[model samples]
Target: SLSDRLQGTFDKLRGKGRLTEDDINSAMREIRMALLEADVNYRVVKTFVSACKEKCMTSEVLDSLTPAQNVVMIVLDQLTKLLGSTESKLVLAQNRTPNVIMLVGLQGSGKTTAAAKLAYLLKGQGHSPLLAACDTHRPAAADQLQTLGNEISVPVFRGDGKDAVAVARDSIQEAVDHLNDIVIVDTAGRLQVDEEMMQEAVDIKSAVKPDQILMVVDAMTGQDIVNVVREFAERVDFDGVIMSKLDGDARGGGALSVREVTGKPIKFVSMGEKPDSLEVFHPDRMAKRILGMGDVYGIIEQAQKVADEKQVEDAERMLLEGFTMDDYLGQLQQIRKMGGLQKMIGMLPGGERMLQQAGNQADESQLTKVESIIRSMTKEERKKPKKINGQRRKRIAAGSGHTVQDVNQVLKQWDQMNKMMGKMRQMTQVSPKGKKKG
Candidate 1:
C-alpha cells in the first residue's frame, strides 16, 4: 500500500533527471502522510522526512541521471537506518553458562507465547533453553508455560505456587541442573505506568540479574507502544523489544518507530501463534517489504529451516524418475511447513499485488482442498493417477466433497506440476555448477 501511494506521488518526478525543491517537497509530503497513515509516530515521521529531504538537496542527487531512482534509494536507506542498520541479536553473556532472559510486557501482549517461540528459535540455533514460569499473578500461568514448554520439548522451571520471585531465583539452578544453556523467564504482564507492576519486574530483575530483559509488546498498539517503551525504559529498563502479534498488525510502522524513538532495537517479531513463526528482525528486509521489493532472503531462510533434506531429495529423485499423487501430497505438506501460500507470496517481490490479482484462488485453504483431493484417492490411484477413469474421478470428487470439475482441476494441476518438476530435475542433472554439462 505504501508502495502504491508513493508511486502516484513520484509519477510526476519519473522523467526528471534533476529534482528541484518543489519535486522534493511533493515527494516528502506524500511520504510523510503515508508513514503517518501507516501508524508511524508523528515525530518519527517528521524526523525521517527531514532526513530524506536533506539527502535530496545534496548536489549529487540533483545531478544524478536517475534522480527518481536516487530518491527511492534515499527513502529505503533512511527507512533501514530508522529501523536500526543491522540485525539486533539477543545479547548473551559469554561468562554465564545459562544465559537468563526475562520477558516483560503488558497484560495480553503475548508474553507467555513469545517465551515459547523464543525457546523454539533458540533451540533451532543449537541452544538448550529452559522456560521459567515467573508470572504468578495470572491464574494457571505456570500450567500455560508448562504446556508451551511441552510443545517445544523444552524443560519448564515452575516454582511452588504463587512465588514469582522464588521462581525467578530457583529457575537459575534448574537451568544448571538440567544443563540448559538458556533460561527464558515469562514475567507477569502489567501496565507500564502501574507502580505495583513496575516494582515486581524490578524485584525479579534484581533477583535473577538476567542477561537480557526483552519487552514483548503488541505491535498493533501503534503510538501507545512508544509511551509504554519509554515508561518501561525509565523504570524496568528492558534491553530490547520482541514485537508480538506482528502479522496481524496492518499498520506496523509504529512498531518500527520504537527503535528510533527509544534507542532500542527490535530483536524479534512473533509473526504468528505457531511456535516456529518467530523470526529474527532484520531491518533491511523489512524496508524492502515496505518498498514492495519483498523479503526473498528471509523467505529462503525460512524454507531452509523447515525443508526436510531427505524428503526433498526423495522428491527430486521421484521428479527425475516419475512423479506420483503421493509425491504431490508430500509437496503440499512441505509448503504448509514453509508457512503456506500467502506467506510464500509475501516473501516475493510484488507478492501482495499478485495476491490482489489472484483474488480467492491463492488462498491458503486451497492447499487443504488439494491435499484432501489427493487423500481421497486410493493408494493405487495415487501411484498411477492415469489409470483413474471417469468413474474413479467422480468417486474422488464425492470423497473429497468437491464438484467433479474440482477433481479435474486438481488432476490438471498435478499434471502441470509433474512436468515442471521433470524439467527442473533435467536442468539440475545437466547443469555443472550452474553451467550446462556437454
Candidate 2:
C-alpha cells in the first residue's frame, strides 16, 4: 500500500531523466505523511524524514528515474540502519544444562503463544525442548499450553496447586532428567506490568535462575508496547524481546522504541497464530518494513553468508558480459543461497515496495517456476538465448511446470535490462568529467 501510494505520487514524472529539488521535497512530504499515518512515533518520523532529506539532497538519481523512488530508497536505508543489521540469537549459559528461558509480558500480548512457538522452533532445530506452564494464577493457561504441546508433539510440564516459582524449578529438573536442551517457562501475564507482576516475575527468575528472560509484546499496541517492555526490562532485566502479532498492520514503532530504550535485541517475531509463523527477528528487515521499503540490506547479508567471493565475481562478470538464461539460473542459485527471492527482496533498499508490486503481479510459486524452467535448460541453451527457439521454449516450460508465456516474460525482461545497461554504458562513456552530461 505504501509502495502504491509512493508510485502514485511519482506517476506524473515517471519518464523524467533527472529530479528537481521541488520533486524531491514534494515526494518526501508525502512519504513522511504515509509513515505517520502508519502510526510511527512522531519523533521517530521526524528524525527519519530529516535524514532522508539529507541523503536525497546528495544521492544520485538514475536517468529516467523518479526522484521519489530514490528518496524512498534513502528512507529505507536509514530505517534499516536504525534497526540493527543482525539477527539476535539467544545466549546460552556455558555452565548450565537445560537453558531456562523465562517469558514475561502483559496479558493478551501473546506470551503463552510465543513460549510454545519457541519450543516448537527449538525442537525443529534438533533441540529437545520442554515447555513449563507456570501460570498458576490462570487455571486455563496451563491447559492452553498442554493443548498446543499435544498438537506439536512436544511435552508440557505443570504442577497442580504449586506456586509459579516451584513449578518452574520442578520443570528445570524434568528437563534435566529428560536431557532436554531448552526449558521454556511460560509465566503469567498481567493486565499491566504492575509492581505485583514485576515482583512475581523477578521471584520466578531468581528461583529458577533463567539463562534468558524475554519480554513479549504485541506489536499492535504501538508506543504503549515500549512502556511495557521498559518496565519488564527494569524489573526482570530481560535478555531479549519477542514481538507478537507482527503480521497485522501494526506500525512497529514500539519495536524501535523498545529496542532503543532497553538496549535489548528482539529474538523473535510471531507473524501469525500458526505454530510455524514464528520467525527469527531480523533487525534490518524489520527496519525496511517499517520505512515502507523492501529489505535489501538483509538480502545482501544473507547472500554474503552463503555466497563466496568467486560466485559474486562470476555473477558480476555475467551481468557485464550480457545476461543469458544460464546467467539467470546462476543468479537464481546465488539468490537461493542467500534465502529465497522474496526474502532477499525483503532485505533490499526498496525491497518491500518491489515485493508488494511483484506479489501483485506474481506469487512466490512463480519465482520457483522461473527457476525450474531455467534449471531444465541445457547449459549451451542457457549460455546462448539465441538458441532457444519455440520448440525449446515449449520443452523447457513443460519440464519446469510453467507456461510458455512465463519463459517469454523472463527473456523479455532480460532483453530490456540488457538494452538499458547498454544505453547507460554509452552515456557514461560520452559524459563530461565531473559535470552533468547528456
User: Which candidate tops lDDT?
Assistant: 1
Looking at model 1, residue 7 earns an lDDT score of 48
Candidate 1 CA-lDDT value: 0.80
Residue-by-residue lDDT tens digits, candidate 2, 300-403: 34555577866645544543355677666666667755544555444333444545655544345666777787788888887777778999989988888789
Cand. 1 TM to true fold: 0.76
- Prediction-by-prediction clash tally: 0, 10
Pairs in clash, predicted candidate 2: 293-352, 294-351, 294-352, 295-346, 295-347, 295-348, 296-347, 296-348, 296-349, 297-347
Please tell me which predicted candidate would have the highest TM-score against the true structure: 1
Off by over 4 Å in 1: 1-4, 7-20, 306-337, 356-361, 364-438
Positional deviation of residue 398's Cα in model 2 after best superposition, in angstroms: 18
Question: Model 1 over residues 32-124: C-alpha lDDT tens digits?
Answer: 998888778899999999999999988788778878878877887898899898889888999997999999989889999999999999999
Which residues of candidate 2, in runs, are more than 4 Å off? 1-17, 59-70, 290-438
TM-scores vs. true structure, each candidate: 0.76, 0.67
Give the Cα lDDT of each candidate.
Answer: 0.80, 0.71
Give lDDT: candidate 2, residue 340.
44
